[model samples]
Target: MTDTSIPRADESLDDEATTPVAVDEEIEEETDVDAEEANGAGREKKSPADSELFRQSEIAADYVEGLLDILDYDGDIDELVSAGRPVVEVVGGRLQSLVGQRGATLEALQELTRLAVFRQTGTPSRLLLDVGGYRATRRKELAAVARNAVEKVKEYGEAVRLDPMSAFERKCVHDVVNAIAGVESESEGVEPNRRIVVRPVD
Candidate 1:
């Protein structure tokens, strides 16, 4: 009788420990599921915005491709979203003509692409277009010019009026001027004649 009772008590203790282990396993499984769900939710939140941008890019690319074909231009086009905006780049030989002087043609093409997107999606888009990396090269040039203007303004302690620049060029200058201390920049005049004035901040 004693031996049988001891065995029974041990079995009861085993059952108690086993029950807690099972509960712990179930809790761990639930925690894993919850984590996965949280990750899924995070992905879902970001994907829609990115997808819309990508869609805009695709539409812009198609429009550009059609233009290139009509123009008998040989080029490769790449579409992407960068800096919260859609961008299309065209690379090929003899593409400088597409970029035109100071990227005027490229700017026009970009506007047309944006209009195409708006027509399709009923939403206006801020799309950037580059041909043969013109914008990238121009940006570097503009950055140097901005620095030079800022230096001049700092040295003279007077407002310096720069030549009329495109809206893109003006923005680049404004950004650079804003970054430096003791100076600020503003756009003056209208489109095609709009320029940046760098001055010492009072």
Candidate 2:
């Protein structure tokens, strides 16, 4: 998450860019992930301590570890800073239940982990939680989907509606399409059913 280049043509959501994924009901309270950055919106902020973010990731990782223990699941946890945000990734076998369908369980668990961090730090965080490499794999799939949608829009000059996706998935599509020229994308509808429409830019 080093703010890597996001130029188009064979690029992906992993191009070192972070998009605010749509918040599930569980994270509505934490939807304002920008609050920390916004605190210094009009002023130069002193470079934040990297340890703070790392500590946040550590706390989240520990919380996740404890959760795995309760569930009797096995996984290896890695906590690190990516693009200046705390990220906790869990990798292991037979962890599909933790990821749930389309990552709904993962999202809820993320909120819980965040709550744990807030309880410990007294500060709201923008930490990201990934389980079973779901997000990474989803990003690649969405990138392909985005590229295909853009190709259609460029060739036909029409808007294409994609299947409904979670906020995280939608943001992945948007990031891919937004990096390309001659096409643009937007989300329509509401939670759980919201989808993306890619259109040719006139």
Candidate 3:
């Protein structure tokens, strides 16, 4: 388990640049609203993260909903929070096409959803999008891969370089390795060529 005492993102994010615009004029304008209005009547401006997260979920939901309509598939969309990120999940039968083989379609849809969010909010969102249980399945697969890598590292006492993976896959492996007791993981090389390096903890 992660140490609970560590400085989490919630605490250290004050210095993080989350907004697309270095100095958002809209935020500055919001600060100048009449005190009475700002207190009671004016629109409460959302933080960049909140805005981007919301936009991402909405766009993904819309896209999925349209696809379902076209495919004549039935599903219910439930939007909510998971892992401290906005998630839109679709639950139904005959919707496997949305997820595609090995989640390739799901990953593609996620990228498009992120692009949609970026277009509207001008900020890149760290949005977690799941459909047809693809993410849950992938999580299990990644956990298994991490365990195998950790065993390899323990046996050889040398770093084990993993096969190339997408950023999402690398992130999953990194998270799993970080949670283990005697191993750590890092990504090396560049995109489309990058791989995870699993090694014994220092």
Candidate 4:
């Protein structure tokens, strides 16, 4: 899932690098989707009616609940809108399997749920799926990583590059870096290998 607090814009090359992110504060690995394509930005994303948005959330909730039933997993599903995006959160115990390693499984499930919504609505959705508070917890972890990168940049006065992260994670890091003074962040490389580089402002 995309961090609603972070402002997303297209990045440029041959210029001061910047972080450009597209899509949900989701719970993994890259889907090989470019920031633009991943976030459904540019020509792809059209704002749907509010009613449609809610409908998408309901569809996603039904889809997720069905999956849970198949897996014999017990969870309470809550569907709602936040930051103008449809969100489905499943809360319960023994849900770590749904989260997977580093939220990989959760991301996959989210895509499937979105597909379910699209199948019925005939429109792509930005529905976010969060299981067991994974999104919030991951966001905090990402924020800490960003703060650490900023500290290193300040101490060494050299660009500090972080390991590759999903588009959503990169955006979370960007949000933290942008909020701090004296340092900046930009994303480089490609999906599955794309990483953020924190630098000290001159």
Judging by TM-score against the true structure, name the best candidate.
1
Q: Candidate 4 lDDT, tens digit per residue, 1-202? A: 3111211234232221211112433322322123324444322344566557777888888888778877899999998655556778899999999999888888777766766676566666778788998877888898889998888888889999999887667877887898899998888888778889999988
Runs of candidate 1 exceeding 4 Å displacement: 1-46
RMSD of each: 25.6, 12.5, 14.5, 11.5
- Candidate 4's error at 10, in angstroms? 33
What does candidate 3's lDDT look like per residue over 1-202, in tens digits?
1111222235433333344322221221111113323343312454565555555677657766766676788999865433334567889888778777667677666655544455454566555567777766786798799899999999989999998876667766777788789888877887567789999988
**On a 0 to 100 scale, what is the lDDT of residue 185 in model 1?**
87
Give each model a TM-score. 0.77, 0.75, 0.66, 0.74
Model 4 TM-score relative to the real fold? 0.74
Ten residues in sequence with the least summed lDDT for candidate 3: 24-33
Report clash pairs, candidate 4: 1-24, 1-25, 1-26, 2-24, 2-25
Worst 10 residues of 2 by lDDT: 1-10
Worst 10 residues of 1 by lDDT: 1-10
Runs off by more than 4 Å, candidate 4: 1-48
Backbone Cα, N, C clashes tallied per candidate: 0, 1, 0, 5
Local distance difference test, candidate 2? 0.74
Candidate 3, residue 140: how far the Cα is off, in Å: 1.5
Q: Can you write out model 2's per-residue Cα lDDT over 33-68, one digit (the tens) per residue?
A: 244345435323324666788888988888888788
Query: Candidates' lDDT values, in order?
Result: 0.69, 0.74, 0.63, 0.72
